[model samples]
Target chain A: MTNEMMMLTNLNCPTCAAKLEKATQALPGMKSARVIFGAGSMNVEYDPNVLSQEKIRTLCKQMGIGVATVVPGPSSDI
Target chain B: MSRYNDWLIRNREKLVIATSGSLIVAAWLLRPLGNTFHFWAMTLAAIIAGYTVAKEAIGRLSTRQFSISLLVTIAAIGAIVIGEAWEAAAVTWLYIFGGFLEGLTLARTRSALRGLVDLMPRTAKIKRGEELVTVSAYEVKAGHVVVVLPGESIPVDGKVVAGRASVDTSSLTGEPLPAEVAVDDTVLSGTICQGGYLEVVAERVGTDTTFSQLVYLVAEAQEQKPKVQRTLDAFAQWYTPAVIMAAALVYLGSRNMHLALTFLVIGCPGALVVAAPVAVVAGLGNSAKHGILIKGGERLERIAKADVVAFDKTGTLTLGQPQVASVTGFELEEERVLSLAAAAELRSEHHLATAILSAAEKRQIEPAPADDWTIEAGLGVVAHGPDGEILVGNRRLLLSRGTDLTPEQAALMVEHEEAGETVAIIALNGQAIGLIGITDPIKPDAFGLVKALKRTGIKTTVMLTGDNPRAAQLVADQLGIDEVRAGLLPEQKVEVIRELQKTGHVVAMVGDGINDAPALAIADVSIAMGSSGTRVAMEASDIALIGDRIGQVPGAIGISRRILGVVRQNVVFAVATVLLLLAGVVLQVIHLGSGMAIHEASVLLVTLNGMRLMK
Candidate 1:
């Protein structure tokens, strides 16, 4: 599994953030997904064999959230 | 048609607001004519506003995720079915308007990180052989020479090889003073060259530079959820569905579908979900702006609760650099004694050795080459020099080596030690020749720092040091410290911290040396001073004060407390608003439109309240 952090724009509501997180995590080949409401960013872990990063981006766009930038890394948590 | 679709996609929220608002106005204007035109206009307004809400609700429902959008959608549909078109339109419009206001305020809270990103120079001028090539800042590599013109941001962290200029380092160190850089002086990325041209050999590029590390750390810190936020999130997971169940129960019991829908409208809990995280992000960003790197929200909470602060003396309260205060020679000149001591300590790496070598350098006295030099831990040094065997250390070292001191010499050593100066005895061939007093001066602001810590609710301030009791007492007395633990080894300092913790005090250990590492790690919160240039200091502590000033400690703690206050206020305000709105719905005083307006207003209020910590 590979982890990536994507900067999300127009992600304002916490309830919507939670819904987005659940939707992204349910995607095929996904391992985990976390939406940080305060920073307006998302951390996703997925398998390349079953899904592509572009597909994940498309999924988020479908949910009305804009992806500004995507960088590969494990996100740090408090 | 595709261009219009693109415009609609880009300005979806604004279009919804515009269409619904115009239709509502048309409905009011047409009410004077006939009921047909008025009803059609009102229906159009409700549909336009409800369209976006319904789309989000359906999208979320397909993924088995319950959202506030779903609740709002259900309320708007119930209103339209009950022939309350104005209520449906107002509810959707106000919710969208509140979201727009929330987005604006949230952006302001995150502006600190945005400002840092904006400071990065996009392009750099690099020297490629004989040609100067302009490339992206990230493209510059180590060993490449970059030219920075006056009034331009330096593109990479490097050492200057030519020219001189004063560079503004406020973005990095938070200090307004611009540092003067010349040949061999290190300059950081994101600092602006105030004047003159300089060529710098890049040492670190891209994410490896200090500027990048700082930005990355701050961003990560802002994203990390605090314990309170996590708990709230867990609560929200069950709370949303539970509210939906309660609304169903209300409909079954009261047989009032409008009241049940109103219950769903006010039950989103939007404000409570966002309360703590927003405050934490704003607080962390504000602290970073002042050059105080709080590791995370957990550390920030610990700092706010720390009541007892233990400080390591050397390199923390004192300058750590010892200088020769006075020298007394017996049966030899002071210069002769200093020369012999410097010769014996020439190859030694001890702190006292540096003081002696620097003294000899000042006097233009060359130290004789020493052979077979040996160090006694916690004592001093012994070496075989040109002038037979030479020894320099404490009086204990002299006695251990069978070197005898006269009554007068012993008296002088005692007097110096009592006066808070470290005494080093110089012995030649088992005979004491001189006594040198080394003094590590207390930091200029140490007294004020202690006073400030007490004023800021730090109950017990203790000083822990490896120096003798007299020396420690002198420094403690000057600083008004509550207690002093002197003559402590490295492990003993850790023991002191452990003891403080056992007494039920939340402790914070402040230090800057390797010996204080254990104590720093043992404390509830560890803070390192003057950590801008040292990676070890940055990694060793929970909070790293980039500058040498001791005042930043209290400043950091103050920020943490203010953040905690804001978080408490936000949570209380959010929950209270929810409870009050529920009461309003139960009494039939609030309708669907007003409930959403109040709900959105509370979320915006929580966000704006959190942004206050940025100051």
Candidate 2:
């Protein structure tokens, strides 16, 4: 519900069974993240100048969460 | 060898072979022991079965390492170690047999969906030069022309390139009647060639076939869990850890190995874990039986939580056809006006024009002869008739000819248009004399469905449509829709749904097909008018009404809410029984027999309760 990045990631958990909680610390360039817990998928919105997807996934893994995938929203589509 | 890998391969094969051979051997071996000993064997079978069942279930569950099978296996071993041979064997057999029966029931649930694969044709008849080759559907190529005989299912998605036929697409689309397809009309794989033979050009093959997609949708639906299940999983996330801790405490405090094993076996959470899924599968089965195809548990879950319902206008609410309703003229007979209009509309492809021509044919009004006929795009058709220049279309079309209608006739046309009635104006000798009114009738159950949705406390009911605002509003007004968003493009429909969902209400959008896909996807719950919808629409929707009536929309929502309620009850009942029995074990009042009996009973109880969702 928050204005976060929409994450399209495959869930290591049950499809549609994950409780998606937005990470508290924003990535340097990211505005928000939309994580679908069951699908193990996440969509993150970022300011290209600030943070990278690789950085976000590394941080999330350290936090004990797996980022199965990360894709930008349609607005980012060319 | 590591015990884990050694056990994985060896134990899996052992369990499979043992269960199969034991079933046959037990029937003959247990006869000498009489009914009491047979009961013991059955009990022992239950335990062994429980372990095997738990392993398989855990594989699917993928939630944690703790398994009921391990618990039962350990308990049986402890009983034997304690020298309670008869009791241990009885417990193991009963647990195994119980699990076998449960597995049988769950397997049957899958069979209902699997039966869909039978809908595809086994072979396809492909044309190559002069020879007709009969080959498997998998061998069929895109763009290859395939001949479908009467009563055969089309093996691939293709366009009708050579013939015309009334294909039975109901199996694919849920529409009861056959759809008439002519040259250039695209036919999907899995639709039966009902009344005629036709040559179709295949466009997509194999896995990309419509049948495969339908099967996938059904599977996906079955696997989709409601948000409630997620919450349940979150609970399990902590629950599993807590149970492990509790089991450890009981073992350490009692210093009784048998009691510790009993605790583990009894605390398996088998009934609790299986309860929601079983109910969901059953609910899906019930939906499929009635032509409603729900794609996932999440949709059912969201439908249960929906507080707002948005409807796509073209097909969901009104009969998609805009028909000729009435004809009003002071100077000309209605039939005469209709005949003139029909003659001019005969070559028109416009939906309203087709309606007029069909109406004229139905009324047995022979179209007047015309010459030099020309249809002006977005306006009326002008033709040279025996009565001079005859024009038929809208007021704009008639006015463009410098033809003026009588004040009364003009007023009538204005009134019809204001009321959202599509009227075809007829002009004889460049003078407008009459108006033929057309209206898309509100679906018979539209109002009732809307009212039922209201009773469920869904506050918003918006109708998104490509129709003129007036026409859309008329239907919306009748249906008691909370909002009317008219004249919207397909993308705009999605935008409206997104905007509405932005308000935090769990929104449900009900529509027919491609026009409704984006909107349906954006909404929390997407319902397709399955019975009369396109394959693309059904795929995009999370839920589909097998029947065309809007009434099923509410029925589906009701089913979802009830299923959720039943799931809640099952969880409560299963948990309560476990806690009660464990209390008895702690008090030392219950033995292995009573614990196993209670466990099976609770499982049956929860399973029976879960089946209520099927109703």
Candidate 3:
């Protein structure tokens, strides 16, 4: 029952120097994530049992171009 | 900005100038009569009188009476024939004074309508490649970022993408409170950024912006009253010929030129002609002062007859803001649930998102930052924290993630949805924790206005809205509306109005939008939420409620009916008295000066009756 998507951190913007900001979405297999729009970076919160962190990064990369990196949230057991 | 309206407004001034100039020339030529003589004054009076007649050509023509110019000319000729040189001069000069007074009154009205032009901002700072370029507000567009310094008007309706500020929306909403907007919060054009520098991404600019559209719509509505089919239609068609025939009959039967002349003066139609327009102008002017802009005399006349009233539900009968109606879930505290949801939605910008954030703030719940947050446009937001993953959005977002819901929770959602409530779900990790119900509450006076209209013999009160049937019906039921037409787009709303009209119902549709414009234009009398800053709705409407309150709709109708009643009373008295006095003149019982006295009395009587609308 541990909410796993909240622990992700360490991000950068793909397009500019703006820092990554925490954002929320109602997407499946992920509870929360940090997004850096300018640098195309995402730090996702999810239960690895339902969605792997790698899959979260792929989802972020496919959603928009210029995605730089995807890191695990704080709660994630990296 | 159509060429016609431009020409009309521009030419209106020119007409005044030409008429005044001609009168001055006539006055100068008559200097032989001496500076103090009435003849010189008459010349100046003729010019001012000429413009008043010319400015309202359609109004004069609508009543089918001899122009005020012709009336003054005839009076002067009569004085000349009577060898009363001073009398001719006095009458001409008095006519000019009256015309000048009318011109001044009308010029003030035009200026009032054009007041919005002064509010346009001089320049906007557009961001390009880290360098800012100054441009006029009209040149900005969507997606362009603009920097707004303190005390500057927000050049367009845009979101604060960076920085924070306190914005005063009082100019648009008339509310005294200043709103605090952070990143992603939307601000409208014309609102002053009170403090702090904020970079806004322009969502709408120029004519497409809300403030410009608001002024434009008001101007458009103010012009909808065309001069055609004036209330004097009946009198205009018959009065002139009737007067000529009556004069001929007097000359033939009495064999007296003086009797014929007396008949002409007595049957002058002055009272009859002035009665309709003065009442209309007064009614229109009074409504404008009350924030209700009636486009024309035709709207006033139509409203006087409209019996079926239709309403647009959202923002019209309801408060038009989403609020948390109820919270369901016992496992976690309500405050904690709201805080979690607000934290997740902090980065999002949506009407419903703002409602949730405001709800949490009302409970004194301070939201803690979530480790990771993502917002799905048109769905919901999700947050990841050390405890678990939380989901907050509509049903689709929950189901797409394979998130299971308890049968009881599912039923509760259905119940709220059926009643037109927007249910904001809160899920902790993968399990549903609670749900927040949001709805736009109905206005307090909505039901009262509906019942009042019904009691006044309005045949039907139909509710037409773009919202779902459940929500629309809920609002309609509360207001005791007889019928509900739900889920109608703007065009559909207009079509519904058109259909009702085809069935012989004189329908009035009340709405606020560009979408509502078509329906408003098609209705027997389109009433717009003039106070709500819906420009398209106001522009498309025949009548706009300056206060944006539904109560004004019925109040306007009441005023129109009362004004019409007075108009009818004056019409009957004026027409009957004029005919009877003409008969008396033909019989040589009424003297010339006495007839003029009575004639002036009738004109003054009608004018005083119409002035009651000013109260």
User: Scored by Cα lDDT, where does model 3 land?
Assistant: 0.65
RMSD of each: 5.4, 10.4, 20.7
Highest lDDT against the true fold, candidate: 1
Candidate 1 positional error at B486, Å: 4.3
Of models 1 and 2, which has the larger lDDT?
1
**Interface RMSD of the candidates, in order:** 3.8, 11.8, 27.2
For model 2, residues B1-615, the per-residue Cα lDDT tens digits are 445653454344346537744753584586786766655554555455445544544553564544455455656666666655455555566555565555445545655544565575668999999788999887788989999989889998888988888898766656678989989888888889888889999888865676666655564566567766666666655665566577678889998877776676677666787678767777777777666777777666667889888888876788877778888766878888888888777776656777888789899998866766887888878888677888888777867877677787778778888878887888888677678898887778787877888776677788899988888888888778889999999899888878877888888988887677788778888888864226667766777775566878877887777778888888888889889888888888877777877888788877777777666
lDDT (Cα, tens digit) per residue for candidate 1, span B1-615: 856754565577777788888988888877888877877777788788878778767776676757676777887788778877777777777767766666676776566766776676778999988898999887799999999999999988899999999999888888899989999899998899999889999998865676766666666676666678777877776777888899999899999998998898788888887798778877787778888988878776789999999999888898888988888898899999999999988889977988888888999999887977989898888899778998888878877987678887788778888888888999999989898899988888676887788778899999999988888899999889989999999999999898889989999989884788888888999998844355566655778876666778888888888888888899999889988998899899987777877888898889888888877
In CAPRI terms, where does candidate 1 land? acceptable
Positional deviation of B371 in candidate 1, in angstroms? 15
DockQ of each: 0.28, 0.03, 0.01
Q: Against the true structure, what is each candidate's TM-score?
A: 0.78, 0.76, 0.66
